[model samples]
Target: MSLPTVRTVADLRAQVAAWRGQGLRVALVPTMGALHDGHLTLVRRGRALADKVVASVFVNPTQFGPSEDFARYPRDEGGDAAKLASAGCDLLFAPDVSVMYPDGFATSIDVGPVTRRWEGAFRPGHFNGVATVVTKLLLQGLPDVALFGEKDYQQLQTIRRLVRDLDIPVSIEGVPTVREADGLALSSRNAYLTAEQRAVAASLNRVLRDVVERVRAEPGTVADAVAAGERALLAAGFDAVDYLAVVDVASLEPLERLDGPARVVCTARLGKTRLLDNFPV
Candidate 1:
């Protein structure tokens, strides 16, 4: 069945109310379109967890940095709707900037600390935009649960913190990363890679994997392992390495040694595309 689409908040709430009237549980999966297996995996998880699933497809302008690819960000609403429906999503909340922001929309949520490093350190205001829109989606849908992909690990944590701090009354679920056969994490931005760049894209995961193994083998060598991973990316044809960190999983603070749960996360540039990936350490 074709998925029903709603662009306005009123229409979205009406549909959700109908679902609630039936006493059915609802889950939400928010996205910026250019849907991939990574996005569909979230929808499938939502379906398994709840009776109805709503996926939002808005390419949030506030989330993109001034230098980042806001205009160039990939979008395919028709294709995304098809994929979401096939994955058992019941509705699509695809809103334009005006609908989401409206006129004189001045408020935004500031999710501090957890958003202050890594992706946050590099992309200013990125997580604030993420937190704001996520807050809106959860409030608007008022779903029993909301699903997010762990490919953006920091993002997942940020949303979790936001929900808890605000008492948003929705459960947040994180689905694992989906990857290509070459070990490259599936991302909408992967479309920007040429054949050669695509080949090199696999190195992001490889370097992180090596770091994880090194950290496990020699726990005191976190700095050395991270530095080596950065060097490995440069030697593997990446244009730049932003960061390769072994950070505490909950706090997102840089770890000198892995005494507790931590993750090896990295971001590197391949041509114009910046890739992010992480592995448990």
Candidate 2:
């Protein structure tokens, strides 16, 4: 059976209100369509936490830069709705660009510091788009909990901070990064990889894992280890390394030495597809 979809804010709120009347707690899993196992895991997490799970499939335009793949971002709402139904999602909110941002839409949520490095550095105004949409989603559904994937660690942190600082009455849960058996973090963009590129993509997780082990074995050589990790990505057929540094898991500040809890994060490109992954240290 296909999941019910709401196209407008009014319909979505009505559905949410009906759910709330029955004392059902709502959990939200927002996405840019192109459903994958990683996304389904989030919906399952939502189901585990709340009585009703709502998944939004909007390829947010503002989040994508001019050169980014907003036009090419894979989308299949019929297939996605079917997948969400099987994953136990209660409703699918697939709003169009106009429905989300009308002719006179002029508001944006600005988050500080957390949006300063990694993805924020490379993709300007990305977090602003994220923060605004997330705020809208939280308000639109007033969900009891919101689920986000740890694969986008920085994004997860940013949302956590956004809700806390704004005093949003919703719990933000970070589901662990779901990976393939060989350790390649599943991503919608993974569909862009060619047969050879797909083979090379698994090495991304391997390099990060090696860096984590190296940091554990000898924290003093973190800088050298990061440099070597970059080299390994290039050697493994990645075209370029954006940033490969160990940083505090909380503050996201660069850690010259791993004296405390940290994460090894990186973004590398193969052709036009950029893959981001991180591991705890």
Each prediction's TM-score against the native?
0.98, 0.98
lDDT string for model 2 (1-281, tens) is: 97889999999999999999999999999999899999999999999999999999999999989999999999899999999999999999988889889899999988899889999999999999999999998898889999999999999989999999999999999999999998999999999999999999999999999999998999989999999999999999999999999998876889999799999999999999999999999
Off by over 4 Å in 2: none
The digit string of per-residue lDDT tens for model 1 on 1-281 reads 68899999999999999999999999999999999999999999998999999999999999999999999898788888888889988999998899999899998899889999999999999999999999998888899999999899999999999999999999999998999987999999999999999999998898899999999999999999999999999999999998889999977999999799999888899877889999888
Report the error of model 2 at residue 125, Å.
0.7
Compared with the true structure, the alpha-carbon lDDT of candidate 1 equals: 0.93
Best by lDDT: 2
- Residue 216 in model 2: lDDT: 92
Q: How many residue pairs clash in each candidate?
A: 0, 0
